[model samples]
Every structure is written in structure tokens, then in C-alpha cells.
Target: MFSIFSLIFGLLSVVIGILATIFWIWMLIDCLKNEPSVGNDKIIWALVIVFLSYLGAILYYLVRRPERIKQTGQ
Candidate 1:
């Protein structure tokens, strides 16, 4: 029988896994949609996200995401 703590940990692990998978997918799509001027090669970014998984996604978000320009209506 699983202990209470063990069950909680297991549940937490599953949740984390699901969240990570979602994050990875979102990052992959974002990378693909990013313009060339926004970063380096889109293919390379996608590969990195695939191979490194969650960590790669975090890295791309932190390091490679482009800055947004504010539109001033004249």
C-alpha cells in the first residue's frame, strides 16, 4: 500500500509531467511561429525544444523570445 506522502508525491509527479508536456508543445509552436529576425534558425530552436524538453522550452522563453513593440496610435 502506498503511504500518504508517497501518494501525494506520485500525484504531484504526474501533474508536473503533464504540465511539462504542455509547456514543451507550446514552446515548440511558438518557436516555429517566430520570425527569422526574432532569433536564429527556427529549425534549430524546434530541435532543441524536442531534445531538451522542458528545460529547452524554458531556455528559449528566457533567452530567445523577442521583444514586443508598442504601437502608438497617431
Candidate 2:
């Protein structure tokens, strides 16, 4: 039960999990604070992040944040 491959994969999984958690929290905070409450945009993004978690965070980071920052100068 002590295979080297298992150990390596377990460690890798832990690291990835930690990183994903950090990114999630970071994105959540960024959205809450920096994302404008112009209408329902902020609420929708917050919901997306909360419900979708890491995948949501990745989506926001890749899809929306850049454009918002550019448009709003946040």
C-alpha cells in the first residue's frame, strides 16, 4: 500500500487542492470588492463563483475579470 507512485500523486493532489482553494478565495474576494454593483452583474458573478467553485473562478479569471478591469479601470 506504500507505492511511490501513490505517494507522489497524493502529494500532487494536495498541492493542487490547496492552490485551487487559494485561487477560489482570491477570486471571490476580488469579485466582491472590485466588481461593480451596477446591476445584477456583481450578484451573478458572486453566485457563479460560490456555486461553481474552482471552475467558476477559472472562468471568471479567464473570461470576465480582464474586460471589467479594462472598462472600469478597477
Candidate 3:
């Protein structure tokens, strides 16, 4: 009993969710691998990503990843 628009919206939602999950996982791995473990950065970022989910990932991608890559070239 789903209309065409409703069906399309549902599919779009699923696709977005899947993409968000992938982004989240990718950020987590990138943080763990590329984030320097000088102090507690890696642990802190991992915790933030784990607790905040996609939002944390987005934050890290926009904020720390650029700086880390620039500083460490990793």
C-alpha cells in the first residue's frame, strides 16, 4: 500500500543510513590509524566516534582529519 513517492523516500532513507554507517566506520579507522598517539588523541577520538556515532565522525572529518593530515602527512 506504499505510494511511489513513499517507496522512493524509503529507499533513499535506507541508502543514506547505509552511507552514514560506512562513513562512520571509515572515520573510526582513519582516526585510529592516522591520529598520532602522542597523548590521548587516538583514544579520545575513538571514544568520541564510538559514542557520538555519525556526528562525531563528521566532526572529526571536518576538524581533526585535516589538521592531522597537514601536520603528520598521513
Taking all chains together, each candidate's TM-score versus the true structure is: 0.75, 0.93, 0.95
lDDT for each residue of candidate 2 in 1-74, tens digit (9 for 90 to 100): 67998999999999999999999999999999999889998999999999999989999999999999899998
Off by over 4 Å in 3: none
Q: In terms of lDDT, which candidate is stronger, 1 or 2? A: 2
Clashes, model 1: 0
State model 3's lDDT.
0.94
RMSD of each: 4.4, 1.5, 1.4
- How displaced is residue 37 in candidate 2, in Å? 1.2
Evaluate all candidate structures by whole-model CA lDDT and list the values in order: 0.75, 0.94, 0.94
Top TM-score hit: 3
* Tens-digit lDDT track of model 1 for 31-73: 7775354356677878888899889999887876643111211
Query: What order do candidates take by TM-score, descending?
Result: 3, 2, 1
Which tens-of-lDDT digit does each residue in 36-73 have in candidate 3?
A: 88999999999999999999999999999999989999
